[model samples]
Target: MKKIQFILSFLLVGLLIACNSDGKNNSASSAAEIVVADKVLQNGTIETMNPDQPTAEAVAMKDGKIVFVGSNNNVKDFVGDNTEVIDLGGKYVTPGFIDAHTHVIASSFTTSGVNVQAAQSIDEMLAIIKEYSDKNPDLKVVQAVSYRPAALGRNPSAADLDKLGLDKPVVALGNSSHDGVFNTVALKLAKIDNNVKDNVPGVVYWERDASGNITGAAIETQWMQTYVDIGAWIPEIMVPETMNYMQGYLASQGVTSVLVPGVITPNFGISSEATRQDFEDIMKILTTRIESGEAKMRINTMPFMKLLDADPDDYVPFAVRMREKYNNDMLRVNSLKMHADGHYNDRAMSMSEPYNKDEGDDLPYLAPLAMSADVIHATIMKATSENINVVLHADGTRVIQTATNSIIASKKAYPEATTRHRMDHISFINPETAAQIMEYNIPLNATPIFTNAVENGKDGEAVLKKYSKETVERTMGLYMEMAQNGANVSLGGDPPGSVVEEAYPVWLFQQAMTLEQPGRPELGAFPQNRKPYTIDDALKSMTVNAAWQLQMEDKIGSIEVGKYADFAVFNKSLRDIKPENLVEEAKCVGTMLYGEYTHNDGM
Candidate 1:
């Protein structure tokens, strides 16, 4: 083929004379070759999260791949004086923010260190646990977390934990491991008495009312492990002061990647050899804080299907020994997660309609809890015959039709593995199960920041009181009707139970590019499931279809040339704002990866 089109036209005219070279290069003095780019964000507007030729302004990067992107008249031939010429005054770059579901080591223990999720009553959740136990009086136990108990429709007692003093131990947490609220000396340091009630071994219903006692309320994940077992008796310098309030809220939320479905176990017996050696010493202390730059994101973690044994074939040899001990790309282990039900504010979703009517004859189906749908389709056909990826948590539409018939019977019995399954909080689906979930190319991670379950549930006012007035303009997302029908979906931020109400989708991309929900004006019940979404289809359900569902689309998400240089910036122009000003007109300042600046912005 004309010598392969003359070696691709001499490598695109030697990459346009090395993008006009000033970017240093005695070409082969190796540090793994081609060291250029000390900087060059150039004129901005990049969005190279790529969808077949998406545009860019200037990208560059050298040692970490993306050798050059476009414009800046070929990146001003790598601007000398040791590079560094940002000028993104035009703002809006893309990629990075691959937080398709998060947790950053339990967001370094909830930022604002001890959140109590904006309490809203019950003496504002005890003035946020009496102002973090009166400003950490040598902390013995304040712990707190995403606690939402139906955003306070009730729960929190033992006289609201004897007015926060049974000589310490407060315990709030409920960003849905169902619910919690301890106090009576953190339920006698969680040795739940009345000589024990039902739920145990990873928590559930520590509930009680008229005289049965123990009403420091709780529902599941074993009564929020009596407030996470009072954090293994706290005081390890409050875990680096909760990891510097979780890397300043993931570098002011431009978050680069997290996954971490859930961890922190000494018990939950999900895995113990002391939690697989504290999951290989917390992935070697989050890969030595993402390698000495002090943790700036990129972690994948998994294990909590109550540590798999409801027999996911006896946890595929501890999911092949945590995919051969945390297989890297910046901290790893891709899947085994599990839940299948609970949370739409504890209607205990397993619904095939029956969250009421006397508990639809007493919890009639949220089944698949500890298995049975042919053992969760032979544990998703033994995690697609060992190519792994099985996540599964389903939120409504009869638990996403039991993970859409176990991903169409494990892609016809692993005819060729790679089911790379995932369902996570799929806030409702129907239309013959969204056409059998777009005929099995399965991937529906949704959580449009649970905008209070369609502005406060009852199936968000019955999907706008019976799809009225012209089937309320045809609706779309579930990842744009599974990518306009060819199916391939992604996105999730149900992290530490909905941080920024489900990790950064910028106010769920202004309610999915304006189906409207900012500060509700009266639940029009998903306006008959409002549709219309574009900003390049919600930035491909958050970048190159969430990095091809974490099979990591040729190195971290986008920006072409041999890949990697990650990305994210933004000061404006997310398609020139205003769908209720895209989350206060965008913010996530900077991020970059392989090529460094693990989290800047103030440039």
Candidate 2:
């Protein structure tokens, strides 16, 4: 009996051992099944921008999406033999920057041509143009961009450009990009002579001398014709190369995405068959680049609404077709762009009151509205009904009110729709308008760089003289009021049209944080009522908030799991830098998109 009990005990022990071994094997298999990341960035201060987990020490990316954002100790599970591990060495990493509103094609044209952004005098600008023309003698058209008359003390006439002695046609685009001065040769080439009638009423016009001769200057819609003509002269191969270079340049500046607010259209003085064909060709080239992995940054474009002679109804189908054709992760075309008013400099922006008249100007100067409220309301309703977005370029208080009223009407009509319509360049706003913007949840794309120019640059004196001191002080930007009211306010540089200096996200952040111009730091604009944004607030404007404006918050805006591994690494931590040095000292070390370096500085 004793022998039998011992054998039974041994058999039971053997069964228990087998059960324990099976449990161990299953645990090991589960550990082995964990997927490894394609790339792991460790030992960095990651500013996740994810409200739930705002900071992390490590980030792991797999298949272009972030797989893990946590402590270094916990990231080992994602590491594998083939994974590229980058030791950040405690560098600061934040979500890639988003330029909410920019004219990429226009900016690229200027960047690739004679950039006269720093020309302080007309002579300097002419000299630069002459030099560029002489250097590129084979070119058919010589173009110079960012021609600010305020900086030159007066606007230049065609005669000024004629003195350059360039054999090729010369065109000098205004800082606004909606106006331009062309030499006699350029005018003749573009067929803009004294007999050219205003094609688009109240929108397109050519300035004339007292002698009834063409002044060589064109404004608004008329400028489009000049551009189209000049673009037609550019070599076909140069277009894509220039665009590719500009994309890489933007990535170097930490921009991963951009919203091109307007594309060339056949309307607005581009009615010629050749110009229209050129526009289509340029767009096709851009599309090919985006599809073939040449475009480094994601682009979201808004088609110009007033294309050719087509009315609002005619635009719906075209916009829908574009949306269907280019709606994807890298490119989107769901928005239609409209002009609500003109610029403040031209005294054409619709305001509540007349501008301060200059000496001998008897009549009060009230800017013209680009579109009436009724027209905007109808257009917005049409766009919203189709679930399409509309972005209106509204700068003045009256225009802002018009746009706000239109948005409110659209929301009332389509309460269940998710139309994220936006208003660009809300340069002037009051507390009442701010409240309305918040109430409707309309995105406010603020170009504070333009405000900076109005308050401190060459335009400051003119702006102060044109409007009442109270109006100038209280209504410029109103960024603080907009933010405090819980409005979705995002920053845009509006480059090429507003000088490249304004496009720098760091400079923009500095302006938002200080409200003080870099050139004039004595007093902040709107000192009494204006409050500066915190660094965090300013960062949000360029990152997630701007992404939200593009309707891409879930993908590229922040560092979080299941989001694209797009980040901009700075040489120094943004939090460690002094607020005043934010613009001058904050340097971008590298920019990454989809776990791969788009722009790197040897680190």
Candidate 3:
């Protein structure tokens, strides 16, 4: 009887053990059933750019969206057996850079053309062009870009390019891209001659010699026609190749998204339908590349207002069609880009004061306003009425004032329109105008790169002459002032316009932090009012604020759960680096878009 009782007790103990094991198995299975992250990045300082959370030690992404952002230990629950874990090894992560305003397509074309951006002299430029021509014997025409007449000490003429002895047509575009020096062959190819009249006085026409003979130099709207003609002659495959290179370059610079202003500038003599179709063809190429995964950056493009006669009412249907066709996670078109004034460097910016003088011209030059206040107001009212955003290219203070006033009037007229209009290249703004910008909550998409270039002697004299010394000393970028005043100011490289060797966000950040020209410690653009921005401020300008300008705050520009996993990893902590050395020391280790690495230096 005792042996039987002991056996029974042993059996009971075995049954309890089995039940506990079954419970453990069930719990493990339940935990496994929870959604797992596709990728987990940890052991790094992550600047989320999310004011609510601010920072994190790890981030988990699932299906191309952030699922977890917190401490490293907290991310473990989101990690699965198949998750591709990346140990950052104490590197720093920040939201991917967003270029608020850029000419991506134009920049790509420049990249593919005879790149004379580095030529320091006319002789060097000619030699470079000769070399490019020699390499491509089959080329029917040569288009060189980023050629600075100031760098050459004078503008090159058709006679000068003829000295190169290239049988093919050749055109060298100025850094601004609004001006160009065409050789005799190019002039013939574009069909510009003595009889070619200037429809837009001072804005578009050929530069003639004293005898009124065309000198093969053209400016403003004329260059647009030349660009189209030259593009038509170039090989078709080059366009996609150049675009591919630009995408890779932008990825290296940590740019995950871009706003391409003015995709379709008016071809002065071309039919409206032809212009629209041309624009569509270019977009199709870009879309094909994006669909093929060759281009990873998100692009928001705006059609040129001039293409639709600068009448927003005329463009609403086109904008709607574009949005219907291309509005997606990767690309969008929902805005109209108009030029209120030309480039500041060209002394074409409409300002309150007249420019000092040109070398040969006797009278002080007052820059011409591209669009009248009334016209701008009408355009804005019409565009807003259609619920379409408008981005204006206004560089000078007067232009900014006009644009702001028009926008205000339009907002009042179209009370129901929820348009987030932006002013691009607000190079000059007085305190009063700044206040107006803040009051309206208008986004200023500025080109800080241009300021840096001016400070560095690229066009310092022109800027100095355009504005009084007192004005120069008081306000340059007014980055801090604008921000303090509740203005939404963002940065854009505006590349090829600014002539940076490479559009590096770190370099731009350095420029903002230093406010001093490279190699010119004595020459700050706004010496007395030079306010160096913090690294955080610069980052926000390139990321969060820029995203806000594009109305993409919900999707990207921050490392937060439920947002796209688009962030860049730096080799070193940006916060720890000295302000001056940020450009030199800071290197992008990796750039991720949609949870995939678009560029990985370590790889």
Give the alpha-carbon lDDT of every model.
0.62, 0.73, 0.73
Better of 1 and 3 by lDDT: 3
Return the lDDT, model 3, position 165.
89
Local accuracy of candidate 2 as per-residue lDDT tens digits, 224-280: 667667553344544554466656767887888888876544233464334334444
* Each prediction's TM-score versus the true structure: 0.34, 0.86, 0.86
Could you give candidate 1's per-residue lDDT for residues 1-603 as a string of tens digits?
Answer: 999999998788666455543233311222233345777778878877555547767777776667667677757655567877788877888877665666546334433346766665677877877777787888766666665554465566667757766487766666643566677776787777766654432124466666767677666555544555666334254345544555446546565665666564424432334444555556666677767877766677776555334577656568778789778887788687776565544445554553333222453333234334566677777878887888776766666777788788778877778657878666666567878777666776666645333324333443333222232223223444555555666566565565554456666666666655565534333434445467776777777777788788888777776677777787876888777677765777777777677667564
Task: Assess candidate 3 and give its TM-score to the true structure.
Answer: 0.86
All-Cα superposition RMSD per candidate: 21.8, 6.9, 7.6
Model 3 over residues 219-287: C-alpha lDDT tens digits? 655565765675533426545554566656778878899888875333422344555666687889888
Superposition TM-score, candidate 2 onto the true structure? 0.86
